[model samples]
Target: MTKVDFYLLTSHQPQIRERFACKLTEKAYRLGHRVHIQVEDQSQAQKMDDLLWTFRQGSFVPHALMDTEGAAETPVLIGYEGEPGAGMELLINLCREVPQFFSHFPRVAEIIDQDENNRHAGRQRYRDYRDQGCSLETHQLSI
Candidate 1:
């Protein structure tokens, strides 16, 4: 069974969620886990790829877009579609709905900021995961 974690942020700003995703990916990568960030589309995927590079000062998280060459060799990958390569241990979902391939990973992270629409979607995803019998947890983030 996949372990699902919902990270709730206090602010509704979209950028906060992206930054948090980058931080989470960095932590996972440092801990020797392969992370695949699932965004909503190509545009969001590109944005996340850019954000991961400059999200923090004096910070570096090696990452590549899913379609690019050498993506398989990278510890962190960003994509909006297709299956991630084997050995991917974590899936960070930025999509509005649950990803079809989420269960393939050992851990799945869903980031939810304080936007009304986001909250509603998050609640639905939470319920869906619970209904599917996945182990679920929630973290209230002050940032």
Candidate 2:
């Protein structure tokens, strides 16, 4: 069964969730887990790709956009549209709804910041995952 983790952030800052996503991806990469970050569109994917490189000073997380070249060779992928490639162990979903290919991964991370829209969508995603029989967990985060 796939495991779903919801990280509820106390801070409502718009960028906090994206920053946290970068941190999570970096940790997963260091731990040898291939990660696929699911976004809503090409713009979002580009945003994540740029943020991952500049999220933290001196921090480096090797990644590539799924539609771009070198993505197959990269452990971390930023995906907007289309199917998530094979061999990815974790899915960090930035999309409002769960991606159709979510079940293919062993683990999924849903980041929810304190924004009303995000919280509402996150709740829906939580319920959707639970109803699907995924192993669900929620964590209240201070950030």
Candidate 3:
């Protein structure tokens, strides 16, 4: 069974979610995990790719867009559609709906900021995971 972690952020700002995603991705990469970040669409995927490069000063997270060449070789990938690729151990979902391929990964991270819709969707996803018999955890992130 996969393990699901919900990151509850105090702010409703969308950028905060992206920043947290970057931080999580960086941490996972440093720990030698291959990460797949599922965004809502191509635009968000591109935004995530860009944010990962500059989210924090003097920090770097090697990543690529899913469609780009050499992406399979990178430790992190950003995508809105299709498979997460072989051997990707961690998934960070930035979409409102639960990803169909989420269970394929050993660990899934769902970032939920303080937006009303986000909270609703996160609750639904939490229930869905529980019903699926997956282990679940939640972390409240301040700031």
**Using TM-score as the measure, which candidate wins?**
2
- Tell me the TM-score of each prediction against the true structure: 0.97, 0.98, 0.96
Off by over 4 Å in 3: none
**Top lDDT hit:** 2
Model 2 poorest ten-residue lDDT run: 77-86
lDDT order of candidates, best first?
Answer: 2, 1, 3
User: lDDT per residue, candidate 1, 1-143, as tens digits?
Assistant: 99999999998665998999999998998899999999999999989988998999988889999979999899999999888988999999999999988889999999999888989999999999998889999999999
Give the number of colliding residue pairs in candidate 2.
0
Worst lDDT run of 10 residues, candidate 1, spans: 11-20
lDDT of each: 0.92, 0.94, 0.92
Task: For model 1, name the residue pairs that clash.
Answer: none
All candidates: CA RMSD (Å):
0.9, 0.7, 0.9
lDDT of 2 at 66: 94
RMSD of 2: 0.7
